[model samples]
Target: MKGGNMGNMMKQMQKMQKKMMAAQEELHEMSFESSAGGGMVTVVANGKKEITDVQIKEDVVDPDDVEMLQDLILTATNDVIKQIDDKTNETMGQFTQGMNMPGMF
Candidate 1:
């Protein structure tokens, strides 16, 4: 009886794993955008935490202050990465709750 119960539990776990994979795949197609320096720089990233785009306003660039432009870009990129991390956690939390499966995520 114990063996039979274990088999059933394994099957249920497999089903949940499949569901989580599907959700992750769907998330890969979703995009999140973040900006910094008053929107002078903007970044777009996918759920996979891959950066897809970076946009810089021309007015933000000054010939004498290239470092300022670089700083803005860096800030925007970091902000986008943070947004991606937050979003991934929130999305995956739905499946992780109540399951203490170590290393599952």
Candidate 2:
């Protein structure tokens, strides 16, 4: 490629990088929620896969069934994290599609 064309491509890549960063910031500000055990347990996670909140229905808590409760919580947490992962892939995949560059991230 000519020097001018290469420069233009670099500029475009930089612009896209900026946009991707902004989109990532937006994602970080967003939250994902998921529930398990028929809404008995719910968990919220940020785009970075950090748990933000957890909620358990009062009726779901049972001293005799602590294991069940734990399972529900785990399921909900995993689901919420998966949601964030999926959204991140969907959002960032747009910028990465058809690009063979490795180690750029």
Candidate 3:
């Protein structure tokens, strides 16, 4: 009886691991974009939380308002980071549902 139970538990664990790996792979190929200052600034980031691009509209640049431009960039970058975090959590949560095992992920 003990051996049978152990084998079953192992199989279940393996299956869950496989599902998690698949979900992670899918996330690696995913991406999200965010903008700030009325779309004057745009940021593109991948699911792995890597920034791919930062676009700033020429009209948003002012020689006398460097501080405002800096703030816009910061806002856009932070927005992109938040978006990436949300996507990662939502995607990983799908695989962790109903599983209470700590650190299993």
Backbone atom clashes (below 3 Å) for every candidate: 0, 0, 0
lDDT of 2 by residue, 1-105 (tens): 899999999999899989999999999999899999999999988888889889999999999999999999999998888888888889988899898978533
Where does candidate 3 stray beyond 4 Å? 98-105
Native-to-model Cα distance after best TM-score fit, residue 44 in candidate 1, in Å: 0.8
Q: lDDT tens digits, residues 2-62, model 3?
A: 9999999999989988988988888877877888899999988887878899999999999
**Runs of candidate 2 exceeding 4 Å displacement:** 102-105
RMSD of 2: 1.5
Q: Candidate 1 has which clashing residue pairs, if any?
A: none
In candidate 1, what are the lDDT values of residues 1-105, reduced to their tens digit? 699999999999899889888888988888988887899999898988889999989999899999998898888888878877777778788889997978755
- Per-model TM values vs. the true structure: 0.85, 0.92, 0.86
Judged by whole-model lDDT over C-alpha atoms, candidate 2 comes out at: 0.90
Give residue 59's error in model 1 in angstroms: 0.4
Best by TM-score: 2
